[model samples]
Target: MKNTICPKCGNETQELYDGRCKDCFFENFKLAELPLVLHAKICATCGARFNKNKWANTGSIEDIVFNTIEDALFIHDRAEDIEIYFEPRQLSPHMYRVKVEINASVMGMPLHQKLKTEVRITREACDACSRISGGYFEAIIQIRATNRQPSPEEIQKCMRITNEVLERMHKKGDRFAFISNSAEDKDGLDIYVGSTNASRHICKEIESYLGGSFSESPTLFGRKEGKDVYRNTFSMRLPEFSAGDIIELRDRVIEVRKFGKNVTGTDLLNGSRFLAPPDEVKGATLIAKRSTAANAVLVAIENNELMVLDPDTFETVTIKKPVLLSAKAGDEIAVVKTSHGLIALPEEVSRKNNL
Candidate 1:
């Protein structure tokens, strides 16, 4: 290396940084700089932080303070291999004092700097929170049954699905994913949602878990910024029959196991697997529930036929044995009486009764 003279310091050195020797160059060098005071906007309800003109989910208050300090910190242009650390202390619920340490190298020489700043939190309602509190909704989901009222259990499950979907959407950065209101009517449940997209997701989730279909329609609600604003209404129809329902369809008594996109069940008369589309059993009549079945006295097992005392008449009657029948002679078994005749319930139903 060749020696050179610094112009500003008039010193002989091996290198000159911006026409200055190392000693003269470092005299006014600053590794980092930070403002004395910083402000961070946080949502009071959800604890989200406002950053870069948008609301974002953040960590705890201390993490937010540390992030704010890091964002406002400025490092020297010549710095290399920079490392930064923050030590934050909460002065109060709305204020924090932070100490920042910066270590870097410039021109093969190590440098260190320490800075301090105060983070003052400003709490306010974010856009989502404000809209939710104001009862602003873009969609209404009406949960109804095809031919009956929605049971309390079904309604509760639907609401649970709606909330779960909205929560997932909100975590995925959809700020409008929120429920504004919900109500129960004689027919079913009515849910008001802030995001139409979230409403569609909720309806899809509900249909996937429970059996049914949904349709959507839009109506003009108002105008915004010279554009027509519309609100969506989703009509969700639940399946006509639910699990454990014993329905007589086309002369076959079926016990519904699941009713999703397709109806799945076991034929109560023969204990054979029965699967069909939702539209296939449209006119099925619900005779009774598996829970409502009566126990009959088993008289004898004659080959493929079972002789059991009628639950209603106490008269011995011969009926075809179900494929899943496990009861021996003289043991009580579950039997459901339909207009067709006495139908022996499956072994699973019998076990449920024992439980």
Candidate 2:
């Protein structure tokens, strides 16, 4: 090993970096370099920040300013184990002053420097925010029932699904996945979505969970890129008869257990499982809700009928016993009085449903 002397300072030292001793090297080295001012593109509506040509969630103004300055900084490549400290102050609504401390080691020597800079928050709506502000939407979701109006709870469920889908899409960097507006109508709910694909996804989710079907229709709205642009409308039809609804179909009292592409239920009169098409269920007449069915006392079970005492009327009546009924004589059971006659419910269904 040989000792080297710094050419500029003429000092003799063994620790030399870039043909200069540690002291001279550090003296001439730039600890940190940054632009005089940094610009931050922030959305005024959603408070999202634009970074690297993308809109992203950001922290407070001070934190954003500090981060912007730190990102734009260029530390010397020779500096090792570099650390930065930022002390920021709000100078005005649009300007921020930040004092930065740079600490690092250059060739086994400690180097420290402080730099002051300013950050200007340029308020401009990001792409998504701008579209939202202008009431822009690419698709509309119309949730309607097959035969009757949807219940409020059902509509709320659809809205919740929409929010969950939007949140997931947003996290995946789909900034256009947003709901512009939602309106409750006489038939169902209308949800305006910011993206056509998102609208389709929302409709699928609603159908999968809520048991329905949806179709898409596109209409020419305008032209883009020298071509015609079209927007979509997703019409989602929910089942008219939901679970726990009693309906008269095929001259039999049926209880709807589930409804989707195929309607599944149990015949309340004969206690036989039933499966039919959505159209058949739609044509069926809604008699009463399973929620309104009353409890009854099973006193006697004949070959094909059972004598049950109605809890409300306190009268014993002979009703058809279902094959699926598990209750023995003298056990309490659910009974629904239909227009034709009284029907005894199976014990399994009684335990399964709250009613």
Candidate 3:
């Protein structure tokens, strides 16, 4: 093999690769090749990179660019092994200088190659960010009470639910799930959402967590893609009465236990439980909170009623004893006075030294 001749260039060489001399082999075989300058599309708002004609949101810009270069490499068949390394240097906010080193083995010979190239990142807004910046929204949520203004605490709960839903949806790759705007008006609180599906999801969460019902109303806004586009407005009405509210209905004093499809409460007059729809509880008047009740002395007990002396007025009045309370005469207990009559409420008592 010391006297081999190459037929293509008539060159003499001891070693040959694919019938090519060492000089020819070196010229023909290439470990990898890339352009001097490459362009990358990037989102100005989200920092997303477009690679291989697709937008990727998973990695950093450097990782994305390195991967793109690795995929664009052309490896020759004669190269038995190939390794690539990148030394990236920032040239500007939108430009970078990447030093690429290619190490390979061809014909059992080691080879090293180096190239310095430029990566230009062109900034453009992504679809989600663009829509967000443009104030694009699909539905509006109106948080209101059935017959009165919503409390601040209720409004805060609604906002928290919306934020939580948006965060969960964003984690699942729905970037368009977000709240665009929020406003508090005299009537109620209004929240604008980016996606209709997200809007519906938020309403469901509100109902499930805060106890409410909502209705949807659609209005024709404009035309899109040669079709009429409509925007939805969800009117969510929360129950007027909340838990811990003492209400008077049908000559009965009841303490609201829970608010759901059916409003549940315990009858403060007789310790009986009652369940009614939200509409039926709407007519019930709020008398006082159980927390506002004062301690009264049980004067006497008779067949289904008891005499209690009001601690505030020091006036003796006969009220029905709640079946759940088993206090005897001369015992101190909590009692509330309502429009219909005075009622004994269930209280938690801890005796110390029989005081």
Candidate 4:
């Protein structure tokens, strides 16, 4: 029988069961899983998840339960060891569904992507097995993202920036947070921040100087600032001045009652030298997120293994090895997600089969 290719996009696809491609099925059922947010069903036969939101096909799922709750075994620094409980995707023994449960899985994200995860099937504690006295069941071995798979050193630059920003907030009592993974309301922002109105003016000034963005998140993001309170003050009048009571601004001497900043260039009783031209600031950068879904920046990082996208063209790429990267700005790399922060790459990702 001819294998089924993705009829929709004409790509070779995975077969979980029956004979439909996962990616094609997902395209047909957009927004299928609202709560889970899975793009596709990894294994459709029995609701088992092979990978996190592979957005593949139903039967194509290899049978993995993501965020499958189980009793914790032991706690390590960044990961935990646990004995998991799960069932197979294929109902009967004649058919089998490859199911796996990983440890230290929070929500659906595997902790750090470098822990040991083994897949085993303990059929049951049925009467026949109970009498066997601690009988051993069949166990299948599985692999993690980094298992004898040589991976590049995990870069923590984003973490460093996040922590640094948090430090700045703490000192000034400001509010901020990493952009939520599923925040669709915020079309152009990667991070949300809240600050005093006074601080906002300062923040905006800093943004103009440093270059980047600072936009308001949606109402769901919570109050941006505390309520403003007005302080009562008694208005005061200045005492009368005598003739030639000197008033000075840089190189100009003006009458006390003359136009206060109402003075423009020629209106300047003050000379041009009285004002130094706008400060020749160092070069600044402007980072504006693309507002639409169609246009995307295919930026590749130069000199470094990172890439940044316009969020519209964000397609996560996971490779067996760290991809080659150019660390120079505008150098060009495949825009991809690596279980890391949004960054650009040094080179466009070649097909795994092609590589």
Which candidate's lDDT is highest?
1
Number of backbone collisions per candidate = 0, 0, 0, 33
Model 3: weakest 10-residue lDDT segment is 346-355
The model with the greater TM-score, 2 or 4, is 2
Deviating ranges (above 4 Å) for candidate 2: 1-27, 225-227, 248-253, 261-264, 270-285, 292-316, 321-340, 346-355
Off by over 4 Å in 3: 1-33, 50-59, 67-86, 100-116, 249-252, 272-283, 291-312, 318-335, 347-355
By summed lDDT, the worst window of 10 consecutive residues in model 2 runs over: 346-355
Give the Cα error of residue 65 in candidate 3, in Å. Answer: 3.5
After the best TM-score superposition of candidate 2, give how far the Cα of residue 282 lies from its true spot, in angstroms: 7.6
By the TM-score metric, which is better: model 2 or model 3?
2
Candidate 2 lDDT score at position 106: 71
Instruction: Work out the TM-score per prediction.
Output: 0.89, 0.78, 0.70, 0.15
Compared with the true structure, model 1 gives a TM-score of 0.89
Per-residue lDDT over 209-309 for candidate 4, one digit per residue giving the tens place of the 0 to 100 score: 22223443222222236744332111111112111122333433322221111211110131221222222111211121111112224344334233344
Residue 85, candidate 3: alpha-carbon lDDT: 86
lDDT of 3 by residue, 248-280 (tens): 887778888767778877877667787888778
